[model samples]
Target: MNEYFIDTNIFMYAAGKPHEFKEPCVSLLSRIQSGELKAAIDTEVFLEILYRYHHINLPDKGADLAWSMMDLGLNVLPVTKKDIEISLYFYQQYQDRGVLPRDIIHAATMVQNGLETIVSVDKHFDIIEEVKRIAPSDLI
Candidate 1:
């Protein structure tokens, strides 16, 4: 019953073409679907997945994927004003350390929700001491 914040890369890998991480990502997602694990994603993460799908000329697929994530019972956390404020602080604190703005927002979302574990392949999450990033393969 552990709750984990899911990052954008995890969804992208689960929905993308075959790759080394695909299988593990798929497995982790399947677990979520089966109610074996609890997972949540911020609005930014959902938008990132949708944008990537559309960017690749698959807008319909993007919509379907978004619906599917909802169907799988993924909790979609809102990006609140507080999250934005924290994101700004994170941005100023980690920008020079190579963390992107979106990554900062993701970290802020997790922090705001009291989530300390994130399922992501992105090493940038590691820069935030409040988050523990785990690759899908590590879970598998």
Candidate 2:
């Protein structure tokens, strides 16, 4: 019953090209869908997924994907004002490490939710001591 924070890249790899990591991503998502593994994604992650789909001229597809995740009962965490404020703190703390604002937001969301594990392809999460970033393959 371990809940993990899911990052946008995991979904992107699952929905995008047939890369080496695609199968693992698909498997991990399938596990989540089946309630084998619990997961939560924040608004920022959802927005990023939607924006990517729209950027690729697949807005409808993106919307469908987002809805499907919701339909599957995935916990969607809101990016609240408090979360944003905490993100600023993370931004300053990790500025020397070259962390992006979005990553800081993700980190803040996880911290706020007491989540210490994340499923992501982004290596930047590696430097965040608060969360353990695992690749999809690790779950599979």
Please tell me which predicted candidate would have the highest TM-score against the true structure: 1
lDDT of 1 by residue, 45-128 (tens): 778878888898998998888887887788889999999999999899999999999888889998999988999888877888
lDDT of prediction 1 = 0.87
Of the candidates shown, which would achieve the greatest lDDT relative to the real structure? 2
Task: Report lDDT (Cα) of residue 43, candidate 1.
Answer: 87
lDDT agreement with native, every candidate: 0.87, 0.88
lDDT of 2 by residue, 10-72 (tens): 888888789987899889999998889999999898888888899989999999888877765
Judge candidate 2 at residue 12 and give its lDDT.
81
Which pairs of residues collide in model 1?
A: none
Model 1 off-target regions past 4 Å?
none
Give the TM-score of each candidate.
Answer: 0.95, 0.93
